[model samples]
Target: RSASNERAGRRSRPAERAGRAPAPRLAAATPPPAFARLGQAAATFSAGAAPTSRATRRSAREDGRRDASTAGSPLTRTVVRVLEVVPTRLRIALAALVGLGLLLGAATVVQTVRRRRLERQRRRLIADVGVLQSALLPEIPEHIGGARVTAAYRPAEGLAAGGDFYDAFELPGGRTAVLVGDISGHGRDVVPLTALARYNLRAYLEAGLTPRATLHVAANVLAPHIGDRQVTIAAAIFDPGMGRLTYACAGHGPPLLLGTDATPVTACSSPPIGAGAPTGRRQTTIALAPGATACFHTDGLDEVPVASGRLGREGVAEELRAVGPEGDSAELLARIVRRSEHQPDDMAACIITALPGGADRWCLRLEELEVDAETLNSGWAERFLLACGVGRPHLGTALLEAREIVARDGTAVIEVRVGEALAEVRVAAPPAVMLPIERRPAGSSAAAEAG
Candidate 1:
């Protein structure tokens, strides 16, 4: 009886344990409410139910979820929820577009900044070029050595300055020398060569060398220095006492001599300076009478392109004649420059006109006189006297007289008449003071008698 009872107890215990284990398993396998609804909809679709409106479907899902919560297993209810805010392709395209826009904007900014920097550098370079040009070419004297001298220089279009240059300076014994030249090219590259040639010519002439000899010396000095560059020069020495002009040319145009007859003084012609071995340069002397004008110019004037053809030497001569002999040197040259139609090269010219009357008739009108004596030393009076071919002694005497007159008369309009043998400084207005000036001949140191 005891053994049978123990067996019954054991069997009952095993059955109870099996029942408890199933209860725990069912609880763990139960699905959530949302996933339970999803399973019901999937099962309904599989059963071939007709599709319904979104609102009807949503209401049906809610009602089904209530039933499923009570009936479905826990494991069948739980699921992951995924929401797509933007389409994958759309998002990728938008990102790419935004990145491309940023890249282009950066590139544009860099390009604009680079352009502005280049512009600034270009302007600074142009300014520097202007300064250098001014230094290389200074204003020349209007009158020198008993001649009315005037010059006109025109650089090539679109250039600040060019290689064409001219200079006129006084020599010993009442003589004047003029130089006109053109280097190979225009602008700053040729400035050094221009300066060297101009100054060397002046120095050689000042040393009492003849025109031909001066040119030879200049060629010798410049040939080795100028590299692959050519130069054309026309040099003239005028002696007012003798009324003679001695000129030499090196691959340059002939000087135009205008008087009763228009003639071109084409005496000497040699290879251009620095071209090759120096040729024996020869000079020609021509009588330069009063009321006559001599025009020296570079090839720019003759090489101007016209409708017919280039304005040759004959055309240049004709233009000069049309300017008329009575015109002032300054006015004449200005008119010629204006008439040029197509000037492709740098133009430089010098016009020398002998005064019709003697030096005595040369009049310099001073509107006002300064109080300082030093002003008398370098004023219109002195410049006019020097232009009138006054020697150093005569110039000193003239300045002394001018100083005395200015001291006596405070501020007055004075007329200075520089004659060959005398200089008269007289006040034109009230408080008049007349200072007579007597000048001795050249090479004589006779004290000037002043009254």
Candidate 2:
């Protein structure tokens, strides 16, 4: 009975406790402002998380409450309480708007920077084009190789420079050489080739190479870089005293021979360089009379469009004929270039005209020197020719035949040919010194004397 009475007493005490409100819970007693602060913090966290649904917001709310409790500072608690006074839904909306604004602003900044960079790059490219143009065009001289010279340079449309280039300089032995060349393709790629070809040709010519020999050396040197690129080159060396022009061609356009009679004749050249090695190739020798003019130009002349597509060599020749001889060479070149309407391709031409003064008639002084046969075969010959701007062809051939002639005989006669005059070279030689050269021109003769 006592145990039953104790159980009833326990039940009755719990019922009494439930009947009275458990004095308000501590969380419920928390001020509204404090609740608002916690709500705002929860929204901030939730905005960052972007969970699947509003239900997940509870996780953020719990995290916020823990952070507030752990803070332990009275000032932080007061501030948090103030923030909590804001409505939870409104707090969440504000945080989302702030986050979106920050993201949009960041994207705009990145895009603006990219645009500015691109504009800078564009400016740099334009400046680079100007620099390239200046370097490609060089100044030319009015006189070359004891002759008056005239030239025309036509730049391609929309380009500051074209692929065509020409040079004329006097070589040793009173020989003068002229070279005209065109590099394939256009733009900066051609610029380097122009420089290479121009300098190489000049060096070879000045090195004493025959026109044909010069072409050979230059073509071989440029072969590695040519790849698919081909070069059209025409070179000529004038020996006014000999009244001959030694010329070679590597697929370049033909030159026009402007005679004193005002008659225009066509001078042909060989195949273009870089096609292959030329072993048995022979140079063309034409009689260049006093008061005669020769013109060399790029194919851009015939490249202009006609109804039959691009005009061929025949068409270009015809055009020059039609322009007539009375016109100045410079004026004629300008007319053709203008006629071409400034072709899309490069156009350049060089003119070398022999003034009325013919050799001795020109009253030029001459000097003669007698040297030994061994000197002709020795390195001295090469050095001498190089100084006079002559002898490259002789040097290359001399090396090959030097030993053969040395075995044939121990002594032979050597001669020096100067200004159309040949002088038998008297050499003091060891008995049996062999001389390789046999044929020599006895004296100067006007092969084709045109009245």
Candidate 3:
């Protein structure tokens, strides 16, 4: 019986040892939550135990699937949000492009309009210049009384209007006065003054005023309007009935006289019309011989510098003589102009040749006036006498005849003795052209005095 009890004690000892920890509960017998928690813990432990092993890989795959589902699900939602922003950004970029295009179009249109406006203004100004230039008549009366007049008008380049003008109109006494003037300054600014000068001169000339009186009136009339600008004028009145010229100058050059010998001479001129402090004086009378020639010109001719390097009257006289007797009035003028071919100044000249009347006889005479008899040497006198067509042998005889008259009057005059009669022969200045001389009627003292 004791042996049987020992076997039983052995078996009971095994059970006691097994029941010491109360035999941990089986995963299947634990509560559902606990069992699930316990299963997750076992899987996590398996993954950690061998991270690269097949069992851990299976556990990792299961966890990865859950993670993928949780994280990848938001990718679609993020893509949708990005797509929503694309349209707004594109709209902004397209709007900016449209705005830039509008600005460029506006700029182009503004430039086009401005350019067109400027072109229109330019055209208008050009038209205005044309009108102003055309207002000056191209045709000048070639014949006025016994005098033939021709003029030339050349405008300066780039100038809107010139300051030069000339007029010829009959006075109230049936005599005609010629007026030529140059107002200072240019452009349309001078147009008003030019018109005023024209009308005023016409009115004054028609009022039968002398050249000097007309100039005085004109100066006063223009003084209020002239401002700082002044005028240069050469005005004259010719009385055909009396063969006399009344003249006045306003700081202008003297007219040239063409003597019968074809030699150029100068007129004795008074002070310019507006130049003198005492208002200047006028030349009441200038005796124009029957065949004498008068030439009026602007300073442009005289002002040109010659090869000799002289200016004004000196140069002009030299040039005129250089042209020689081969050239006529027009030819000489052309030659004078050619000397200053490239000059910048404008030139104008008026030449008058007086022709004698029909059925009349005239003689041309030349005399040198000097006080000293030594100055009047025979050679010098002979040369002038020869030029005047007086015989050399008769020169002393002519001088003797002239001395007799001088002895009686304390003056000297030489009478050139020519074999031919004075009635048929004609003489002229410059020898380029000849004019007839009419005999004065008897008892016409005024006319004779004027001649």
- Clash pairs, candidate 3, are 249-273, 250-273, 251-272, 259-429, 260-428, 262-430, 356-436
Tens-place lDDT digits, model 2, residues 103-148:
9999999999999998888667645654564356455566655566
Error of 3 at 183 (Å): 1.1
Clashes of each: 10, 20, 7
Over the full model, what C-alpha lDDT does candidate 1 score relative to the true structure? 0.67
Query: What is the full ranking by lDDT, best candidate first?
Result: 1, 2, 3
Clashing pairs in model 1?
Answer: 29-74, 29-75, 30-73, 30-74, 30-75, 31-73, 31-74, 31-75, 31-77, 360-419
Best-performing candidate as measured by lDDT: 1
User: Per-residue lDDT for 1-451 in model 1, tens only?
Assistant: 9999999999999899987765543456889999999999999897777766899887886677656655656654431011123566877897799999999999999999999998898777766765575466556676678677777676555444567888888777767789898888876679988899889888777776766667777888888878889888888887777666667778887688786242322322466897884532445556677777888989888887777788777877788888766554456445556766766776787888776542322222111222234444447455544544456786676566556655776432333343334645444322322222565785465434431
By TM-score, the best candidate is 1
**Model 1, runs deviating above 4 Å:** 1-131, 159-161, 260-268, 325-342, 357-451
- Candidate 1 has a TM-score of 0.52
Model 3 segments beyond 4 Å from truth? 1-131, 172-174, 260-280, 305-311, 314-334, 358-451
